[model samples]
Target: MAPPFAGGEEDEEARWCGLSTDMMEMILKHLPIADHISVSIACKSWRLATSDIILPALRAPWLLGSPMASTSLSWGFYTSSNGGQSLGLEIPTEFQRQWCCGSSKGWLMHLREPRNHSQYYEAHLLNPITGATVELPPFPPTVIKGVISTSPFATDFMLAALCFESTNFDKYVIVYQPRHPRRKKILIDNAMDIMFHHGRLYILTDLAELLVGVFDPRWKVSFKSIPTLFEEEGRHPDTYWGKLVESNDGVFVVYCTITTGAERQQLKVFKIKEWGRHHRIVEVKSLGDRTFFVGPFSDGVSISKMKSSSKLNIIKPDHIYYITGSEYSLWAHCMQKRHTFRVEEFKMTGNILEWFIPKLEDRSNLMVVTPTHSTSLLLTIIIVMLAVIGQCLLGWLSI
Candidate 1:
């Protein structure tokens, strides 16, 4: 692509500047993430196209400050896209004093003690990269971790979590839905992890059971036990760590196990397939274009079906980045090839590290600009004004 001011005929100029936004997006879709800035600089139309195409693309998750780096105040994270580089971001001063209890997909859930005389703590979702926050209702101290459904500013925003404040098997899952004055609770017990998938809440329990929660006119969570893989197949329960992840193939429970070796390269992955009451755990070799990130502090987030053009090439396809309960280190492993990359020095508080995806700047607050070119639109406007002036002069002279 030549510079915008390169010598060109009218036809060449038209060809470069006349492309419609849709056509520009089609071309930009094929280009790598690195070429987007160049395309955006080519012309106003391409800049519009770049904003349309890139805003919704998959963003790389941030490696939240290891727990050791975190004190009671002020949290930090690494972008990890630039081979572990820093992106300037601000964690609100108030949040610095709060606890970051939950994090996922560009949002962090913080719990703060009430400034007023209230019994319950206040919880809210904060997007550090965007400096936007959604005010949440007061929550009891029993709340553990939270998962935000979408952007906190979105119309359909919802928050769900596993709580300890409730009695066992009763109201263990708490949900804060849009347009609701108070939160809702679900009845489930021993929930190890909670995830929202296909418009339903899935809870994994310590006993290798699944609780599917549906919020219809009322909240109902159905339970199922799938232990044939561990009980019948003789796979030791202590040998693996499990979490639920969504894929193009559907939701599956990923059981990851680290084998004993000097290289520590062996990582096995398996999925659970259920039909009525019969459930079979199947070995999975590949995760396709999907990638999963799991840690002790947040729900397993699978950022899947990504475009090849994203700067997040560091996140390998079909690979899972996991942290076992006993191990504080992070490991990225491929199911089929068993290729592994381990980084062991991340000393987080309680050895916990949460994955965070940074949100773009608040679009509602950004100043929108109308594109104008001095050699194009501006010149045309000047010519039209000059013509109007000439016509008025001729009429005045005749009068």
Candidate 2:
């Protein structure tokens, strides 16, 4: 009996469809992280291959907007690659009324307010993609300024937060672990920003000092000052903000300065140099294809080739993309061009805009495939393939 659509054409189709699993995996590995879930659903073998595959570490940064209201469980993601379109992500119910303190390595630190006066506030880490949550111990009622972690997925990773004891001036840092009595507090003068780089923690102070802390084998933290990067110019005209970032080249401190009522913003990058007792910070004019994304929670530098396009809209190489407290307005300071511009595409109404890096990991529950999103991704891939095929066919006919 002959089956429907079974002919010489069917044999050719079958042969074409029988691509080796290894070949399919290699192809999938080169695709963007957004398309992984869609490709996995194409067949059983592809799904298995995706399950075993480890994605590349390079990814572009997405802007994560705050949840609309206390009742809303959805947050908006503004992707520059998609022409700055905002995508709505439905978070878990536990995050419905919480405040997002910080985000690092695909994890968000959220503080849940107490339902009543008798209960204390609780903080937890959430992976919005996988809807997995891990609760920390009760936190003091202080205001949380920022949070950073040494890879949230690891068992021994340390979670630290910069907090203010009161509205006046008392500031401190708290480190959290997964075990009981989960927090340790450290008093510091004043910290403007905190960052984790290469198993050590770096803190920037308002007085323009850089402090580095290292943990001993017994887990005791020892703090030391890095060489003075800047000298006080006795009442400078411009206000400065400092951020510590880790790039492929080395650790850098980015200082952004804006003169009062001036449209242009200035950026300075300094590389850290250490040779035994000699420590120095050298100013550099070029960032070498690295673009930094700076915010209150975390500051990160992304290489040019890692992004979808060499230039991310107005965000060019050697530029720093940042948001100010003035209604969460977006701005970029270009080191190469020596100019600053406002990114008007970001129609922000509130203050909770932060840079988010989407990670595709093997263990995260957030990787569960959603049918609708995967379908849209599949359609996009198909259209791209069709366009390529059309171009090839035209070329072949001409030849």
Best by lDDT: 2
Q: How many angstroms is residue 246 displaced in model 1 relative to the true structure, after the best TM-score fit? A: 2.9
Against the reference, the lDDT scores of all candidates come to 0.61, 0.64
Per-candidate TM equals 0.66, 0.76
Mind giving the per-residue lDDT tens digits that candidate 1 earns over 1-399? 333334656544555556556655655554433233334543555456566665332355666653454555546665434444433344778787787888755688888888897878888888665456878888876776688666667666668887775555333778887767767777566676777765567777766666665565544445555553356565565644567765545567766554674246455455657687665667677877778777765767667764433354555668878654444556677766777766443333243456776555344433233223224433442344345557668999999
181, model 1: CA deviation in Å?
3.8
Query: Which parts of model 1 have CA positions greater than 4 angstroms off?
Result: 1-49, 52-59, 66-72, 116-119, 153-156, 165-171, 218-236, 257-281, 304-314, 324-328, 339-341, 344-352, 359-399
Least lDDT summed over 10 consecutive residues: which range in candidate 2? 362-371
Q: What RMSD value applies to candidate 2?
A: 5.9
lDDT of 2 by residue, 82-163 (tens): 4455544445666756777777777778887776764457888776655567777767566455455555667667777888
